[model samples]
Structures are given as structure tokens and as C-alpha cells.
Target: MRAPLPLDAVLGLASDLIRAPSQGGIDTPVAVLEVGARALGALGLAPRLLDDENGQPVALMAEIEGGKPGPTWVLNACIDTAPAGDRGAWSLDPFAGVVKDGWLWGRGSADSKIAVASFCHLAAELAKSKDSWHGKLIVLFDADEHTGRFGGIKRFIKERRDIGGVMVGYPENDIVNIGARGFWRAKIEVYGTAQHSGAVSPVPKNATVKLARLIQAIDAVTPPPPPEGAPFPLPPKLTVTGVEGGSGFAMVPNAASLNLDFRLTPAFQAPVAQKLIEGIVAKLDAEIPSERPTKIAALESWGAYKLPADSQLGTALVAGASLAAGRPVPGEVCGPSNIGNYLADLGIPATCGFGVTCKGVHGADERIEIASIPLVWDAYGHALEKLLIG
Candidate 1:
């Protein structure tokens, strides 16, 4: 058997992972996976890499087998981070992976790679010691989470059915996140005919103007009523994220497009929201006839869910968090995350929201406090021990 990895080795691995430029669209998650595989193999565990249809490296699954019969517990963390915007604002190169002031500076430092490293470290240590645990320990490092497709988890679930519990290492400052808001994304496009500015002006039509009106009307649509038995305190909401139009400076643009992003309460289903959006677009189409016709396009839709606070997994996670934090941990649901949807749709009793306290996750100067890294590691170890091994 290999020796357990020391703290220095664990941090070193984390630092290396942070150094890898695994930003969402351009990230090579496989590079980070390779590092994890090396560390896991050194500790006698097996690591496997999985890819999506485009051969884009998506996730890593590492496993440690035990002889006893017990439920399998999955420890998952995303290996991708949002692109680093405006390098001038950062103290160090966003991909430099520098460590100073007891903090690790890099794109994936806090948003996720730290947790991935921590889980790998935990698995390596456990494997070395041959910890007399009963259940299987599965570590999943995913990509494409920041894009909100639940891509990696969705793929893993489809191929396997033995996952008994899941611990998502999202930054929650050790608090257990049992619920999250659901969301859907759509795009609306409008078409108009292009005519010379000198043409006779009987009825001038501008696609940009019509698109703006459609945006205003869609924004005015009332949100649906909350689900009858929903537990969360809020309702679904919508926001207009992007707009593009006008092809030339001299002539009125003949076409325009807008992106709609909606974050919904668990009460609403994706299909229902899609239908509602289609109806709104149909109404707009009727209102703005094709003197130049306009079209509404639905880009993508994802459902939302909220786990009851009283559920077994939810209560256990909270209890474990309180124990790890050495104080009472208050539970709340305020953010939109894919965790709830994954658990609800897959019928998996899972608890999420375990990681360091990080600000600027999807913003500039993104960093994870070096001090919080070890604390998060210890918290996850304690929580896993309590849930899977105890």
C-alpha cells in the first residue's frame, strides 16, 4: 500500500491544478484530471476520465473499493471556472497559480478546483490507510457546471445507478445547501425588411424598434403562481441578458436578437415555462406583423427544485455541517444552482453546498483564501466520515 499523502503534497496538487487554465469554454479539464489521476494512482486508487460527444473532457471519476457491503457515497466537485475577465484588475496573472498572503490566486482556486483537490486528497489518504469503511467512495470532478447544463452529473447518472448519496463541494462556507432556484434560457429574434433611407416613407419599419417593444412586453409578463406545496419563500423571476441588432450604421438593421434568462422557483416546470414563453412570443408576433416578420427562438430550458428541510439527507447534512463548523449552521436557499435540479430529477437523496467562503466566484480577482482551503478539507472529511463511515 502507498503512504498517505501529507498536507504539503495535497496543497501542492491543488496549486498545480489552479495553475492549469481550465476556464469554462477554453478549459482543459483533462489536464487537471491528469494531475488528479497521478495523485490517486500514487495512493493506490483508480481514476477514470470521461468525455462528452465533442471529446471535450467533462469529468473524472475516482474510486476506492471496500470489502464490506454499504451504500456508495459520491464526492463531487466541478473542475471548470468562468473565464477570467480583464487581467489588469488582478494582482497576479489569473492563471499564474501564485500563493501569497496565505491565499492561492487563480481562476479555479476557489470556484471549484480546491474542492476537487481536497476530495482527491481525502480519497488518497483513505486508500493508503485502508480505512475500515463499509461503503464505496466515488469522487466526481465535472466540467460544464458553470454553464448550467448539469452536463457531467447528468452523464454519470445515466451510466450508473448505485449512487446512494452525493456531496457537492460548492462554496457554501460549510453550510449544507438543500435547495436551489431553477432556471431556463431562451433567445428571441426579429426580422425586418431593409429599405433605402431615400425610399418613399409610407410606413417605415425598423426591426430594432420592434424588437425593443417585444422585449418590453415580454418583461411585462406576470410570473406564474407558486407551486401549491412549495417550501421555498420566493417565486420564479426573469431577466433579459443580451440583445443584438443593427447591421450597419447608415441603414436600419433588418434583424435583431435577444436572450432571455429566467430563474424560477421550484413550483414551475421547464415545459410549462417553455409553453408560456412560446405564447408570449406568439403574442408579440401577432402584435408586430411581418411587414417584416419577427421570430421567437427558445434556446434552452432547465427545471428547478427545492429539497425539504426536514428530509433525511437535508437534516443529516445540516447536522454534519454544524458539527464540522463547531457551531450551529443556519440553512437557507437564496441562490440559483443546479444541485437541486440534479437531486430532484435523478431521485437522488443528496446534500450540497460544502466549500470555502469565496467572493467574486464568477467575477474578477477570483480567489480562494489559502487559510480556508484546509478548513474546507477538514470539514468535508468530517462530514463524509459522519455520513458514510460512522
Candidate 2:
């Protein structure tokens, strides 16, 4: 059919994206959206900037009406990039968008502006051959993927929910990923009676001390390992990422808090994980004097998501994509992705795949394979055609 997406053009688009600094949670992400919108507009589609009317998050949406009636297909890619950490660690200027040794080097090169570039490439090609498909293709330029709030998609779905399915783009090596592990977040407060530190002996009944001990107790409990020969593989994990409290340097703080981060497997959903944590607190409370008490409140939680074994999206990806890593070899081949996790919860048939995955995501010197750009573009087009034309 249409010529395979141009390798040079795809890389050129990625370079443009990498050149724009949309460091997640830091940079505003407007420039990247502008870049994507310009690219889509150049392809002769009517692209629109969508604001999150409920609040601050915003996204760019481009819709292409098919010649015939059918379900709407969505292609989504997050425009925000994780901040490039410690620039000195990178061999090149983190924002330079340097192309060297057959790779595109920059912070968002693979995590995941490349996927957005791939979406643009697919849209361009599809627009050139618009008659072959029968359904509308909606391309979403997600604006708040890495803001630590997941603001874009969350806002979008709230406004529109009749989507047939979403074709999500996130880095998952080269295979089409159909599932992802679970994640939970919480805040725990350890309370104590504030008193002058000078009057205290061994930090007597200190909230900070109580908080540290509770953290230690949590660390001591071993979660059950992934099942033997488990089809989908991921070990449970818990880490206390932050601790805060104390009103002043002169007194013992009355309340101290710890931020809980948990990465879970299907074996432990939110309630189960919450119960386990509660048990640990209860046991620790029994060992402590009644004067010191602790409480944990869940801030957010999401269970692991797996598409149906014969899911429509999964099957299409398996048959449609030609990956550098070879086709998806069964089992669960994925990591933590808000894209997969959210769609899976919506019971939406979504599959994530990309031609390349970068090194040191959320770190310095991120880069993606230069050649795989066109490869993934082709695969995305194939998947789109299969879903739209069939």
C-alpha cells in the first residue's frame, strides 16, 4: 500500500520533539504540544487544542473522519518528558537532540516522544490513504503524563467515555505490551505528644522515632514472591519515599508522616495490600505503648491490568507489528505504565509497543534507536489498518 513511513522524516520529527524541552512536571509541555499540533496540521488534519476545563491539564486532539461509519479508534501518546536529571552524567547536551551512532539522544527520545512521533507518522500516512479505513482516528497529545498527577488522560476520559478502545504508545522495549503491574500510594501518620527535646530522653515518645520504627517494621515484612512459573512476572515491592513532620527545631514534633510507595503483582490488589499493611501496624502498635498511635491512609491505588487472553487489541498487535525484538513472545512483557494500567482498568483493549526503548529514563543521556523509528511507524500503521479496515 502506501510506502513505508520515511525513516528520515520520522527521525526528523523526533528531533523536533526532543529539541523542545517538555520535561515532565517541570516544563509546561506547551511547546511539545505545539510541535505535535503543527505536525498534524501540516498533514491536512484539523487539530484542536483541548483544555482540561475541570482544571489545569490540557491536551491537543486531532480527528480524521473516515469515509465510512465505524467505531472511533484512539491513538494516545504522552508529550511530557521526565526531567533530565544530573546533566553532567550525560555524554551530550540533554536538550541538544543529538543524532549520533545511529541513535536519537535526548531526554524524551524514548520515554516517549518517539512514540508520539510514531503517531504523527501514522497519521500522515493514513491521511494520504484515507479511503482504506472505515472509522475515525482520534490522535491525543496527552499533556500531563509525568506531572506525577496523570492529569491529561484522567481529565479526557472524564469528559468522554464511549471510546471503542485506545492504542496507547509507551516504551515497552519492542514488544506490544498488553498488561502492567499494580502500584499503590499512601501516607502514614505517626502521632506523639510534642514536648521540648531538652526534656526528652532517647527522644522520648517522639513522632519521628515512631515513624522510623514503623517504617522499619514495614521493611521487615516479606511479601509473598511471584508464583512459581508465573505467566506474568513482577515481584511485589514497598519503599518509603518521603518523611515529613516537626513544627520547629526547638520541639519534638507531634505528628510525623511517611510516604508509602508500593509496586504490586496481581497477587496483591489494593484491599489486600492495605490489609497487609494494617496488620503490620496493628502488630507494631501492640509492641508500643498506647500513648503512641499510627494511622495510614491510601492516597491512590491501581491493580495490575491484563487484557483478555485473546484480546482484540493484543491479537492485532501480535499479528500486525514487526518488531526488532521479534514479535511479543507471550507471557507478560511490560513494566509500570500509566497508559496500560489506566486502560486496563477501563476494560479497554489497549496494547503498548514501540520500536525502541531508551536507556536511563528519568535520568541523564536518554536515547532511542534511530532506525527503529520507521519500523514502529510501520507497525502502528499496520495495527491501525487492521483495526480500521477489517
Candidate 3:
């Protein structure tokens, strides 16, 4: 029999994972998955490597069967981290995986890599235990979650495994996250007749001015916070992230565009938001002459989801997390995550929110609290042991 793995071993594994630059849009996480696979294999568990259509690293799934039979628990962790910006902002190399003063500093150390390493450690330890649960424990680590393309987890679910419940370690500071808000993006284009600054035409209109008007109109429709009976606290909000216009200083540009990003609460529907945007564009078009037409184009849409408080998985996660953290876990609703959407859409009882307090997740000096790693690991281990191990 293999010697029981120590917490230090788990941290070591996590350090190795953080050492790899698995940033989104660059640096494939294949090496990290390979490390996880080797760790799981040491515990007598077989892991299957799942990849996207492009063959980029996505996720890894492993199964550990119990002595008897019980609920099949799914523990998920995203393997990818956002790119580390501005290296000068950090005291150490973002990919160095430096451990100093009981803290681990790295790009993915906090945002997700720690959770991934911790859960892997827990799975390995559980597999070695004599205590028998009635059900199976399923482990999933994905890479595409950062981009929200649903490539990683989507492929994992297509395998048709019976998943009774899911627990996602997504940097929640030990909170029980029931669900999150959704998101939608759009681009508004305003058209006008170009004219020289020196010469004034009979119908002189500036496309940039029209675009600005449309932007203000869309901003006016900002969604309000959730009602008293709503599951989440935030209201729908809109932000114009980008705008572009005139090609030259002296030219009155004929066309201009503004990018709009909206966060939708559960009460807000995508179609409704789309119609609202279209209405704004129509209003702008009406203001302009027939010669100029304003248009609204939707870039992307993702629906909001709220897991029922009484959901089996939600209740179990709350209970397990409370026990693990040695405190009453407060339920929270976060911004939209591909995980929450997948669970709600598939009717799977799932809950996310875990990991440490990461200061710069996608920014420079992205790091996890070194001291929190063991605590998070223990919490995850105990939570899984309670919910899945029965």
C-alpha cells in the first residue's frame, strides 16, 4: 500500500502547477493536466483526458468507486488562469511559483490552481481510505472556463456520466455560491455623411455624435437591482467598454461604433435586453435623417441562472462547506459563470465558489494566499468526504 500523502505533498503539487504559465489565450495547460493525471493514477484512479475540437487542453475526469453504492459527486476545478499583466507590479516572477512567508505567489496560485491542486490531493487521499461510501466520486478539471466558451466542461458532460451533484472550487473565500448573473455583449453602429470641416453640406451630420447619443440611450436603460424576493442581490447593469469613430482629425467620419457589455440578473431575459438595445438604435435612427441609418449588432449572449436554495446539491454543499470551514456558510450569487449556466441549463444540482483571496486574478502579481492553501485543501477534502463519501 502506498504511504498516505501529506499536506506538504499537496502543496508541492500545487506549487508545480502554479509554476506552469497556463494563462488563457496562451500557454496550454497540458502539462498541468499531465501532472494531475499522474497524481490520480498513483491513487489507483484512472483519469481520462478530454480535449477541445482544436486539441487544446481542456479538462481531466477521474473516477473513484466506493465499496457500496451512493450519490455520485462531481468536484470540478478550472485549470486555466488569466494572463499575468505588467511584470513590474510583482515582487517575484508571476510564473516563478515562489513561496515566501507562508504565501504562494504566482499567476494561477489563487484564482484556480490552488483549488485544482487541493482537490487532487483530497481525491488521492480519499481513494486510499478504508471508509467506504455508497457512491462514486468524480473529479473534473477544465481549461476553457476562463474564456466562457464552454469547451472544456461541455465536452466532459457529453460523456453521459450520471452526475448527482457538482462542487466547483472557484475562489469564493469559503462561501457557498448558489448561482450567478448572466452576460450579453453588443455593438452599436451609427452612420452619417462624411464632409470636409471647411465645407458645410446641406445635410452635415457627425456619426460620432450619433454614436454618442446611442451610447447614452443604452446607458439610460441600466437594469435595477434584484427585487426583495429575488435570489440574487445585484441588478442588471450596462457598460460601454469601447468606442471608435473618425478616421482622421479633419474628417467628419461617416460611421462610428460603440461596444456595450451588459450583466443580466436572473429576472432579465436576453431577448428583452436585445429588444431594448434595438429600441435605442431605432430611436437614434429616427433622430437622424433617412440618409443615415443606425444599427445594433449583438456580439454574444449568455443567460442568467439561479440554482434553487432547496436544491439537493446546494443544501449539501452549504452543509459540507459550513462543516469544513467551521462556520455557517453564507450563500451568495455571483456574476455569470459557464459552470452555473451549464448546471442550471442541464438541471444538474451544482454550486461553485471556493479558493483563496487572489488580489490580481487577471492582472499583474496574480497570487493566492499561501497560508490559505492548506485550509482550502482541508475544507475541500472534508466537504467532499461529507457530501460524496457519505
Candidate 4:
């Protein structure tokens, strides 16, 4: 039987990463990536940092090559984490890397830092027994993931072309995620006549009121259902994320804007959603004349994707998860768009989610269950063996 994963070492490394500040938009992630590089180096692998045009570290990569040639597999996880909100609400410091009650608590303990540690150790173990598997194993730690830039993964894909499949180390245990819902995001700006609040001679158009109407209209939209035989049915959804308008009480606001976030399914794609919103804006413009036509500026968008049940990546992952859990582990399509959606757009097969169980992600008091590490290690190891050894 294979030796058990280096649990203590993995936890220690995870704790070290957790102590580093890499909160998206708040802290620099390059520092955390440096820490990751050192950990990989400690595993007897030569890890290199990938930089963008600005010569800033965006990602870290370490490759373990087998003697025989076959498909290359990537193990990816983000080092950047969501901002620590309301530090006062936590029982301990969000960056303390506390291990208590069989849990590792920190800002990134559950989001993905732990996976970075786990993947590094797993790759090291595999390197020691390379004769058992063929092809190459790539361990990637990405930065700018939580910031929505995804500069790290984007740069990696743009520079390399031999990736066969990728497994994103997102926290979960019940299901092996096969796909994810896509998204169409935009910013709508509304214009109106500005005038003094006391002036009655020129009736001022209330931009806020118009924006409210638009919000109501969008809320009433019922997106089309998923494809007829979609194994994992995911419906499209729209939400008005933000609104900004009047500054003070005296003057009537001349401009206002609202952010629109629309989740997409295969049936309700980006184009269809965009056209629907355009039609709504036109209708609203004609009904209530504004100073300028309402403008919809497109933000980043990605298409939805779902892998077949028999897909090699998904099948192997499910089998591995089932073995680790001691029960049947189903393949699932996640509701939120993830890095897998980005890879899917490039026609690359990827498993979006599968890892240890965690709680309070992107929220206060985030922590990972320490006991779940062994099961996650086994699942990924078995899956890699199935894919590489075959």
C-alpha cells in the first residue's frame, strides 16, 4: 500500500501560507506565491515564478516529469483569498493560522491555501515514485484569482499548450464538480435633467426613479431554462449588484448607474441575455425619455460548459472520490462560474471542484476541517494514478 500523505508537514506548510497576507485587492499576492515557491523547493522540486509584462509574479509552477510520455495533467489552486471581513467577528486573528479543535482557521484556510500545500506535497510524493505513472504533473499556484483578474492562469495557458486536463483545488467533498455556470456582467448608466430641488419651472427628470424602474424590469426577467437533457439543470439568474446616484439632498442628480450580474446557462447564453437587456433598455428609453440614451457597457463574460458523464477527467475524479469517501460520489455541475469556465472556453477539460470540506468561505471565521485532508489526498492521488498510470 502507498504511504500515507505527510499530514503534519502539509498542515505546517498550510499554516505558513495562511499566515501570509494575500487578500484580493487588499494585500499583495506575490508574497504568498513566494512562500509557495519555497514550500515546493523544500519538496525537492525546482519551482519557478511566472511573471506578467510588468515583471510581477503572477503564478508559481513546478513540474515533475515521468520517464514515459503521455498526457500532461495540471493541479491548480489559487493563493489569493477574499478580503477578511469584520475581523472583530472572528474568535482568533484571521491571519494567525490557528489550529484548534481539529480545524485550521484563517482567511485562506478553506478558500485554497491548504490546497496549495496539499498539491505540493502530493507532487513530491509522486516524484519519488515516478516509475508508477507516465507523462508529467504540473503544480500551479495562481494569484489574482479572487480579484477576478485571473492573470496567473491566463498567463500560464497563453504560454503553454500541452495541458491535457486540469483539476482546480476548490474546497468541497461531497461531489466532484464537472462544470460551472457562466456569467454576463455589465454596467448600465442612466442620464436625466439636473436642476435645483426648489425649481418648479423646469421639471427635472429623476434618474434614480428611472434606475429603479430598470432594476424592477430586470428583476422581473425570467431567463430561459437549461437544455432539454442537461444532466445538471442550472437556471439563469440576474441581480442588480450596485447602484450609485444622487450625492446630496439639495440638487437633483443628473446621472446614475447600476451594475448588472447575470448568470448564464447553455440555453440562456451571453448573446441571448445581452439582446434581451438591450431590448429592455430600448423600450424603457422610448417610454421615458432621458437626456441621453441609457448605455450598457459590457464587462467580462464567460460561456457555460458541462462535461459528459463519461468524460475521462470527470469519471476518474468521481471514482477516486467514491473510493475515498467509502460511498458513491456523484459528478456535479456547480452553480457559480469558476476557473473551469475559463479553461472550457479554450476547449480544455477541467474538474472545477473537489477537495477537503470547509466552512465560512469568503466570510468571517473561515476554517478547514483538519480530518478531511487525508481523504482529499487519497482522492486526488487515486485519480491521478487512474489518469496517468492508464
Over 4 Å off, model 4:
227-229
Q: Which has the better lDDT: candidate 2, or candidate 4?
A: 4
| Residue 308 alpha-carbon offset, candidate 2, angstroms | 1.2
Q: Which stretch of 10 consecutive residues in model 3 shows the poorest summed lDDT? A: 1-10
- lDDT of every model, 2 decimals: 0.73, 0.76, 0.75, 0.90
Model 3 spans > 4 angstroms off: 1-5, 129-131, 194-204, 245-251, 289-292, 336-338
Superior by TM-score: candidate 1 or candidate 4? 4
Against the correct fold, how does model 2 do in TM-score? Answer: 0.91
lDDT (tens digit, per residue) of candidate 3 on 34-66: 887887787577888997777766888888888
Please give the distance, in angstroms, between residue 27's alpha carbon in candidate 1 and its true position after superposition.
3.6
For model 4, residues 133-201, the per-residue Cα lDDT tens digits are: 678899999987988899899989987778889999999888899988899999999888888888878
Q: Model 1 clash tally? A: 1
The digit string of per-residue lDDT tens for model 1 on 1-390 reads 323335567668778887777777766567777877787777677888777877766778887766667778888888877889888888788887777877777887787887887788787766543456777789988877776565788778878778777878788574567767777788878877777655676545678888888888878978876666556766778788999998556676678889888887766667777778787777777877766455656666545655665665566667767766778876656566566566666777666676776666777767777666655666666666655566
User: How does each model score on TM-score?
Assistant: 0.88, 0.91, 0.88, 0.97
Sort every candidate by TM-score, greatest first. Answer: 4, 2, 3, 1
Task: For candidate 4, report its TM-score.
Answer: 0.97
Q: Pairs clashing in candidate 1?
A: 290-293
